[model samples]
Target: MTTKRKPELVAYTVTGEGEKAYWTRIGSAWAHKDGEGFNLDLAALPVNGRIVLMQPKPEGDAA
Candidate 1:
């Protein structure tokens, strides 16, 4: 049997640089059982932006 786990990180499409950067949520990633790699699920792929992985924000904390 296989169990589903919550995503360990959130994926974002980043544009610009430094303080003027923009981050948009684009996907999520889950670690493999062996911790060797991750599986990424993206809702929208970017054509000219960088893809970044970050830890998800805590519940109810909107920045």
Candidate 2:
């Protein structure tokens, strides 16, 4: 017999300007994506995990 575990809740949002990504909660054990909607295996991430939108830094701010 197989048993399914309840998914833990985690909050995340989208990155780019494509879809309207509201602050939503998802299971910790579920594979989630960052703001770019990229595929990320966040099954081991904490509930407060934050995925930042990695865009090219500005020329002056490229430190």
Best by lDDT: 1
Summarize candidate 1's per-residue lDDT along 1-63 as a digit string, tens digits: 133776899899888899998888998998888999988888999887689999988889884
Best-performing candidate as measured by TM-score: 1
lDDT of 2 at 17: 49
For residue 5, model 1's alpha carbon misses the true position, in angstroms, by: 2.7
lDDT of each: 0.85, 0.36
Structural similarity to truth (TM-score) of each candidate: 0.82, 0.21
Full-model lDDT, candidate 1: 0.85
Candidate 2 C-alpha lDDT tens digits along 1-63: 122533233334433344654443232332234543323324233345554333333457732
Off by over 4 Å in 2: 1-3, 11-13, 16-19, 22-49, 52-63
Candidate 1, residue 9: how far the Cα is off, in Å: 1.0
Off by over 4 Å in 1: 1-4
> Could you tell me the TM-score of candidate 2?
0.21
